[model samples]
Structure formats: structure tokens, C-alpha cells
Target: MSDGLEFLTVEPASDPVARREIVDLLASCGLDYEKQIEFFVTARQEGRLVACAGFEKGIIKDVAICQTLRGSAISLRLVSEVTYLAHSQGYQILFVYTEPHNADFFLGCGFYPLVEVPGQTALLENTPVGIKNYCASLAHYKVEADKIGCVVANANPFTLGHLYLITEAAKSCDWLHLFIVKEDASLFSYHDRFMLAKEMTKDIPNLTLHGGSKYMVSRATFPAYFFKDKGMVGQCRTAVDLLLFRKYIAPALGVTHRFVGTEPFCDTTRKYNNDMKFWLQEPSSIAHSIEVVELERTKRSGIAVSASEVRRLLAGGNFEKIKEFVPKPTFDLIMNKYATSV
Candidate 1:
């Protein structure tokens, strides 16, 4: 163990050289490091980046250590510091995705394992907010015999297509929980997107809106889900995320059905839908079986209505075209707030 190391925060934008070094270090460790990280803590030995860990939301990712420092206390200290920072920032829990071999290190550091996929990856968390606590938090909504359904969406700006999906799903269930992605990585802020979703769905009597927990398919749990280029990593992350949902969120909410809009484009989303179907059907994956509902297309010009399309039209100064894809509420919001920027 090295005694001369100092721990400090690394701001990627202000220090480009340190950012490059951290990226290189993570890549050399065979971990995906291209995703945006909000907070990073590093252990420097004489001003050299020896070990580092990143926190995005509540997830600890892109953890890397110099080979010479692997067996020492450096990695443990890095995790401890990052977890402390996360706690101070009001995160009640912290999740980490690490390779299977590194599971023991985190387990020893008080991170209980949630899901381990042999040689692939292990999902672990450190805090009292484990699966049970997460499930317990939502227990008030669970009804004994209600046919509860769920739809998790980013809703960058809620669109007519999203409304159509929710409408269709709501018709089939006694109750529906709509989780707007709380991750603020999209073009529209999470606050705006969530507000749009709530405003659009307010009239639906059976619908209840909830902010997506960090445990959902946010950048924290599935960073690659947002990256179009990293298909393999996206699939792996999606599987882990869905597994967590099946094990924790679904049963807690009494969700017997999961609804999603059909993905006509976006191969990544298509794969996610397929994986949802696969994992939800596995007997051991959940307490009770969940029916994965893929609703049909809501389209114009034979193209599906999507937030990305809305963004494209807004960028092109085609407000009229954007109006055709989005609901009235969303269209009004874009015109009022984003038209001049476009």
C-alpha cells in the first residue's frame, strides 16, 4: 500500500489533461468510460492518477486503479470517498456495476450484491435502501388484486405517441404507474419532461405519475442505454436494469403488465424491448409473471412519433411539423420555451 497518495475531486471540463488521463485509465481497465460523469474522485500518487471512481446520480462507475495499486487499499478508499460524497449530496443509496471478479472487493466494503451474472457484471448497492427498502417505499400503491400496469419513459417532451401508448395501456389495467425518467441527460430537463407528462396525463383517472428512481433505466443503472454506439454494453446494462425491476420494482407495485411503445427505428430500443420480453418471461426472474406489452405505432409520414424526431424538427425551425408529432401541451411548451433557441 502506498502512503503518499492524496484524494481529490477531478473536474473534467476545467482540467482537460486529467480528463484524458482518467479516460485512458478506464479504457485500459476494459471498462466503458465515455459516458458523462457528474462527480469524480481520484487518488493521486505524486500528482499521477493512480485510482479513480465516478458518481453519476447515485451510481458509482468507471472505477479504475493502477495495476500496482490493485491489491492495496486504494480501490477501497476510492469507493469509500465516493460513497461519502454521494451521501452528502442526499443520495440515500449507491449502486455500482463492476466485473464479476471485483465483486468481492465491493462486497467487503458493505455493498450487498443484487445481481451477479457470472463472468459478466455484478450489480451491488451500499446502504439501507436495498431492494426491500426500495420496494417498501412504493408499497402504499400496491393493491392486493388490482391489475396494475407500468410504463417507464424518458418523455424528453411528451408526445402524442406517448399519450397514445398510455391511453391504450390504461384501458387494460385497473391502475397504471407512469414513471417519467428522472435522469436529466436529455435535451429537455427532467423537470420539464416530467411536468409535460403529468400535464398531458392529468385527465386520466387511473393514472398515477412517479419520478423514476435512480434504480430505473436511468444513466446511473444503464448508462449505455443512452449511447447508440455501444450496442453490446447497452444490452448488458439493459438486462441488468430489467432484472432489477423484475426482482424489486414490479412485485412491489403489483405490476402484472409492463407497457411500451413499439420501436420502429432505434435498434437499441428494439433490443431493450426484446430483452424485456425475454427476462420478464423467465420463471426465476420475478415472483409472478409479467406480460410485456408492445403497443402499435402512432405515426405520421409512416415514421413513428419520437422525441428525437421532435428535436430534429425543432432544430430545423419546423414548428408546424413538430406540432404534428407532439401533444398540444408539449407543442405549446416547445413554442414558448425553445422556439427562439431553435
Candidate 2:
């Protein structure tokens, strides 16, 4: 086995750093946490309390919950424990909003992705970090006609990488649509994801973020079995979903340029990305797909960081892998959740 980092759990809403970390992680993942869950902590593994994983009490309502720190195997073990605990306590299932990269990982954890819903992306509370109030007052309003860039992220936890994407997208566009997917409706609700996306991207100039209420952010947009059906393999040619989105959602929001990731680890994304290129390349007024590369990872695994890979490591019970992908504050929050589960 790999050398693992110790785990730690914090009291709910305590430890300012830990709480903030959770906020950041969810924001990175695009799940609004402020109004979604009743927080709890799990076991402590290291001298430093890392919030590995946490759970929502009782049965889930149309929302998903965080299960563990990204890329931590111990966290996966902890999530399993929480599953048993929640089940014994009369809980039906432990939910998580995740990217297609980790679909196999979750299946290994015994989580069967729902075919109908895929996973829901939630809107966060009190406006996401960097969004403007221009779009907030209007409920489900479309963006300006003069759109430039777009950030299409699962925003699984709304991290700095997300912020950077928005920051970069806005630099080139007059209007940036930070489309936070209500992806993989798991424990974290769609509202939370949107809200978190808004919060994190709020500061970016010309950046107007919105939630995917129609489920564009979700795997449901493409097909069932997100992980298995991720990027390259799924129904090729026209995503149909993206085309439908271009027909319906874009005009409403006035999205001109659609920004996406250049990360290749996610096979499903690779597939969808091809469709995005094909569609965007057309005579549409929208700019070509803006492909943003990963910020850094110059040292260790030359492979770019990804939510799917992160989930895989976490579900596999690995910790060291997370350190490379997530921030310290974020890592701490996940560890705290792990402690609570144990």
C-alpha cells in the first residue's frame, strides 16, 4: 500500500480554517454547502486534523453530501464506515456529487449512479464568491448577447483551480458564463453547486456565472453511467445535449465563448470535448472552445489534476495523492470529516 497521511476530524462549524476549507472544497466542486447540510466530523489520523469525509444526517432530499477528501484512500474507508453508520441510523444512502472520472471508483464503493438524474449540481448560498448581482436578482435569466468565454466545470468543491479558470476566461471575453453543472446529483444539491460557483467566481471581471437548472451540468445531459460513459466512448458525433444547450440555454444567457478544460485524464470529458469542438467550430457567433490547461503539477505526476482522479484516489483509500491535488485548508476539512465517520 502507499504511505498514507494521517486523518483528522473537526467539530462542526468550529475551527475556522477547517470550515473555510470545506467551503473551498465544495466550492471547487461547485456544491453550495452553506444551506445544504448538517455538518459533522470524522476520525483524526494526523497531528493535524484533516477533514477526510463527512455525511448529512437522515435521508437525502434532492441534495448530495461530501464523502471524503479528494485522493485519499483512508477517506474512502471512512466513507464506507459512514455508510454503515448512516444506514444503521436509518439512512437510506450516502450521496456524493462527482465527476465521471470517478464513476468506477464510486461503483467500487457500492454507489450505483442513478440513470434518470445522473447527479444534481446545486446553487450555493448568498451569491457565489465572484459572481455579479446583475444576474442574481433575476431568477434563471439568460446572459448578455455579447458573450466571450465560459467555464464549464463540475465545480465539485469550487476550488482555486475553478477560480483561476474563471479568472482566465474573463480575461479574454466580454461576458463569461460560469456554468456550474448541477452535475451528478449526489449528496450535494444543485443549488449549492451553483451558489458555490457564483461565490468563487464572483470576483472575476465580466464573469457572470449561472447554475444548470435544466441539468446541463449533470451527466444526464449526455447519458447514463457517466463514469463508464465518460468523454471519448459515449454517443459521439453531436452530444445533442450541447447542441440543445446551444439552441436553448446559450441565447438565454448570451454565452459566446465556451471555456473548457484541457485535462485528459477524464476519458468521458475527452469524448464530450470532441463534441464541444465540433459544435463550437460551426458558424455560431460563439467563439471556439476555450481550452484551459491545468495550473501546475510540474513536479510529481506529470498528469494534470482532475476531480475524477481525485475521487479515485479518495475511494481507493489513498491520502498522499490528495496532497498533490488539493489545498491544505481543503485537505484539513476532508480529514475532519473522516474523523467524524470513524
Candidate 3:
């Protein structure tokens, strides 16, 4: 608020000029503007943008400050303001991905370091005990098994392919843990996906259904997952997401294997499955190796069953075709929810 400094909140969709200015400011500071960044907190000095930070949901991105104001309080003030903006919108917990060298800056702003990919990216959170607390909560559901396997899926509409993967994974391990993606970015809400997963897997006696959290595959852990064409951003976020699981989630429940459906359609998912092998199976000081099991996707009518296909049928009002891909409960729910509209 000094030296002719003024701060303004910007939403890129509403203000293209401000977005361009923010982009140029970030480029000047040697950072690329990331997509899906909904809001920005910018510091303008005498009508010129000097510093900015982007906010999307609970994750902070592309934080940059003018070299002239690097050591000044503007960086701290900028972070504080964006953090306040997140909190005001009901984001109690927040995550930031920054260059490893810049971790100290956020650390000074009440963000605790979580994990770093060294020279690539560093993940930090506002709560020091966030991961620890999440792991501790998971401890209560810890099943006593020598071989525990885990699966993390969005299961957008919980198709037959999902049922096949879970069924096969549960058979291989003594006990299996299923975690549904908590983020509601999908067409199906988190509530609906979770319910569908529960109803489909209720018959498996050794399986334990856990609600998704920030520690799992979420916006905080993997924001790039919700977007396509992110390039290196996808790689960086994938590493952090897998490391969080290998370092914390796996060991907390004695999980030794991660079962994933073999991706046949999306390049993003195929790459993610490959990354899992490196992050989970490769030896590291963080934790023991977890075997990655890639299962073939179930098929119907000579085609691999996929939620995307199911959605396509729903869009066309082809309930008859949709029933071929999804289970009875899923079809019933879809019919009940979309029958009249279709």
C-alpha cells in the first residue's frame, strides 16, 4: 500500500486486458501463465503491473514478483492477499506449486513444504499437519493384510469397466482400498461418483471404501489432471500426486500395490499410468516400492467400456446403448436423473 502501489483482484474471464497484463508480468518474471487459473491478485505500481499470483480453486499458481520488488514486502503482501481471497471463498486449506528455490517465500507466508521434485516444482500447503492428519485418519481404516492394494479413480459414472478393475484388483490382494477422486470437476458430482462406487463394490467383503481427501488425487495434489494440453505441467503435477501417495498414503495403510485400469483412450491417462510405475515402483528413500498393476479395461460389443462412451450415449439419448456399458444401478440412476430430459 506504499510507494504508489495498488492491488487489484482480477478474474481473467471478465477482464481480458488485465489477463494479458498479468500474462506479460508473469513472462517478465520468467514464468509462463498457466491455464484454468480463474482469478489473479495483482500489484500495480503507478498503473503498471509489477507482480501477480493466480488462483484456481484452492491451488495457487504462477506467483511472480518484479525483480525490483523481490525482497520488498510486496511479495509477502501479494501472497497474503491471494490467500485471503481463497479463504473468503471457503477454501480452508490451500496448496501452492512453486519453484524449489522459491519455497522459502511461501514458507514465510504460513505455507508448509509438502514435497519437491527438485529443480522442477515444490508443493506446499498452508497447514503443516495436513498430510499427517489425513494419514492419521486413514489409520483407523487400516486393514491387517500382508498385501494391500489401492485404486484411485474418478469413475465419472461408475461403468462396468470400473467394476471389472475393482473386482480383479480385490482378487489379487488380501485387501483392497478404493479412493474416489474428490474433486467435482467431472460431469458427475463427487457425491454421485462416490455413491456409485459404493453401491457397485458393496459385495466385496475385503474392500474398504475411503472418501477422497486433499492428500489423494485432488485439485491440490494434481491440478493438471483437470486440464488437457498442459505439457510439462502435467508431468510435474503427476509426480507430486504419486509421491504423496508413495510417501504418505501407501505406508499409512500398508499398501504395497496400486492397481490401475490400463488406459486405451486418453493420452493423459496412459501417460499417468506409465508415471505411476516410475513413481511407485522405483526405489526411493521416501518409502518402499509399491507394485503397479495395470488391468485391461472391460469391453462390450467389441469396444472397451469407458465412462466417456457412456456419457456420449447419454448425450444422444441412447439409453439402450448406455445400459450396455454401465451396470444396472448406474443405468437406473441415469434413467431416473436424465430420462425426462432425454
TM-score for each model: 0.86, 0.49, 0.93
Q: With candidate 2 superimposed using the best TM-score fit, by how many Å does residue 321's alpha carbon deviate from the native?
A: 3.5
139, model 3: CA deviation in Å? 0.9
Better of 1 and 3 by lDDT: 3
Weakest 10 consecutive residues of candidate 3 by summed lDDT: 226-235
Give the alpha-carbon lDDT of every model. Answer: 0.82, 0.50, 0.88
Using TM-score, give the best candidate's number: 3
Each candidate's root-mean-square deviation in Å? 3.0, 18.1, 1.9
Ranking by TM-score: 3, 1, 2
Task: Give the residue spans of candidate 3 off by over 4 A.
Answer: 1-4, 231-234
Residue 23's lDDT in candidate 1: 89
lDDT of 1: 0.82
Predict model 2's lDDT versus the native: 0.50
